[model samples]
Target: MPRWHPAILLALASLQLACTLLLLASEQGGRARRFLAALFTSEEDGPFDYSHPVDVYTNLSAGLESMGGKSMRDPVFLSPCPVVSPLLVGPISVQLSGPVNLSIISRRNPWVLLGGRHSPPRCRARHSCAVVIPHRNRELHLALLLYHLHPILQRQQLHYAIYIIQQAGNQTFNRAKLMNVGFKEAMRDEEWDCIFFHDVDLIPENDRNLYVCADGPKHMAAAMDKFGYKVLLAGMKISRPSIRLGRYKMIKHKHDAGNAANPNRFTMLAQTRRIWRLEGMNTLNYRRLSREQLPLYTNITVDIGPSEKAPARRLHG
Candidate 1:
């Protein structure tokens, strides 16, 4: 029997290992190719110009650990976010005529929860507001307003949710009645500090217009471009004369279907004091067709019955 030389044996062993690796690489396909490429490639050959050795495994482990640590710790937020939110970038341009993507808005504000609810992550909001929009057949207007409003609400650093109270039938749209329904529904969801009756066709122009109800009741809509910046009561009309807090730019639009101005609206208005207590939220009878907690808002469709239905007397008082 002949004895093999040690150096020759070493060389043969190395060749066998090399053959094994080649076989494994061939069997494993892309994964093996990437592993081999990474194993042989120098840091200098990579797309990134690293000045120092980067321990990728260590970095990845550290990142995972850091995320885990963050998950364990409770997030501490400041209460009553600064009056002038640092997030505000005032007077953003609005596009009226265009396709607005609700999904994109949802992605942009990741903190917003299901049913279009958001609270500032950095601070506890001064006030929690429920924004109620009376809607019918104004899909474009609704989409456009929501596209513009979500970012504004985020910037304001206030806790808020958008509720779209849509009338179900082809009857004359009752804006005030829907608003009353919205108020009732909104309260059912949360003990909100205040409710803002928002019109679907209005898009706010500035982020400085905070949605917080600070003092007593406030009338937010003071001026509009549609009405030559005049005080239009039909939509968005009030605030301190000096401050531009609650101003909104009414989207240029005509009356929507089923939403034509009621000829007797003034006549109804004149009888407001007479029917104020009985016919508001309590006396109304409505059937809810659908209520969806959508990604961007809480949508509620209701059959408000015929416009001429006799008002039910208030159960209370």
Candidate 2:
């Protein structure tokens, strides 16, 4: 056996240490990347070279709850962004902490505009998306959702904006009605290519779960941690292929007070075909109370009126 020189042994040990640090940094996200960058500064190969400031809207506070800003329509990129985004950070470990400060999040994710709008700077996005969330009294849930979701969306390289349609005055919290209102309002603002009716508490654990719409209306929350990695649709059976796609991590919380299970669900299910035409988006009636354009999202508070007048009358006949 040949004896190795001291210099060769020392070099081999240093190479092994460097390799180990790189593996660790890949899993640990930004903090570990910063440390790695400090240790391994170079002219052409560092994380800082790839890191660029996200392009956000400059004058977002110029108009009336202005969801349709001139900035969104402005010509930015020539080439279409890749379907499989290169900027993805893979699996995310979400934080279920208390109310998060928006200012801190804004600094962290500079790509998102005043109305939670983000568009990829390097390439034209394939899907122009609007995420409508029905909210009532779940302020903490909303804050946490925004905290995790913004970064994920940015990494996905999507042209997306988040809309929070808040219900005004307590009236048993009609989630479906709020969603109808959200759809109507979002469409009125812009002709979005796709829209996602997202639940406020469903935080995605992976950035691979794209928010873009499919050929049909897609159910996003297929596998959730709350249901032991089962489909969130409860009794409705799903295909194995789809179940593999829509995995999410939900924030743990007790049942909300106002959002009790509908007693008329069974009755309504039976008469769904009979009243299907008259019931849905056509019968949506809500009075807009206020609109506020915040740094992260657009909050539109609305009075959905009494439940008796909810399914008032059909548009035709």
Candidate 3:
């Protein structure tokens, strides 16, 4: 609904092309070299440290590989589908999906260690959240997200954390990788709870965007005052008529960049940076983006995925 929408889309597309055109300075070699060089090449440096979580996650971790190895299924029209796990954590089998029913479980200390009503509790909250964000030069966005989202959590009585994994070295903005980062980060802090890899620019207008992580990574950006997107109805929506898709429309917008992380149509912003190696130091630390230029990946609650009652949000860069 703003005059700048078209311009923003065009500019983003052009920048993406520019970044894509670059040869990535040797892609994987650059990341490995930079990280490794940070050690032995330091001349005074000692053996490499795999203890750093970021390093472990990005470099020598089996988590990404596990996810990559598994083929993700897009939920067709139905109820929330089950995500199969090889008993990595939690119960042998877990069924998590949809907007969730918090009434079945206690809001206070939802985690088992937090002291729930009972084992296999009444299911107060199905509690699972995922934040998929499209990112570029957003350190400020991340800082502000930490600033605002933390308080919002306190007020709304939601359980979540701030995940800010920028595009590796020099790569394109990968929204999904950011989501994966949030997944990993949130897991690091809170287990059993869902993860939300949200955009730094968008903040939820209502507490209804419950911090409970919803079921299976909810999108809080269903609507934001900063951008021109809106949900027609309050509950389960059919279509987001007011929201205009931004540069995020392309599935490869970010993910297709450099990371060979088996990107789905899930808006490859983060992994794209890793696999394709888009923007690096020059773009990541660049000061060109103001609060105005950065994009907000909005939310949409509609008759999507498996269940009509299940609320979901659509995102755009």
Q: How many steric overlaps are in each model, in order? A: 4, 0, 46
List model 2 lDDT by residue over 96-211, tens digit each: 76338778767666567788887765567788888999998888888888888887776676888899999887677878788888888888878998888888988776566677
All candidates' TM-scores? Answer: 0.66, 0.68, 0.30
Range of the 10 consecutive residues with the lowest summed lDDT in candidate 1: 53-62
Score candidate 3 by lDDT.
0.32
Model 3 ranges with Cα > 4 A deviation: 1-136, 213-217, 224-317
- Model 2 ranges off by over 4 Å: 1-73, 224-241, 308-317
User: In candidate 1, which residue ranges exceed 4 Å CA deviation?
Assistant: 1-80, 224-245, 308-317
In candidate 3, residue 273 scores what lDDT? 29
Best by TM-score: 2
Cα shift from native, residue 264, model 3 (Å): 12
Worst 10 residues of 3 by lDDT: 241-250
Q: Give the Cα error of residue 215 in candidate 1, in Å.
A: 3.3
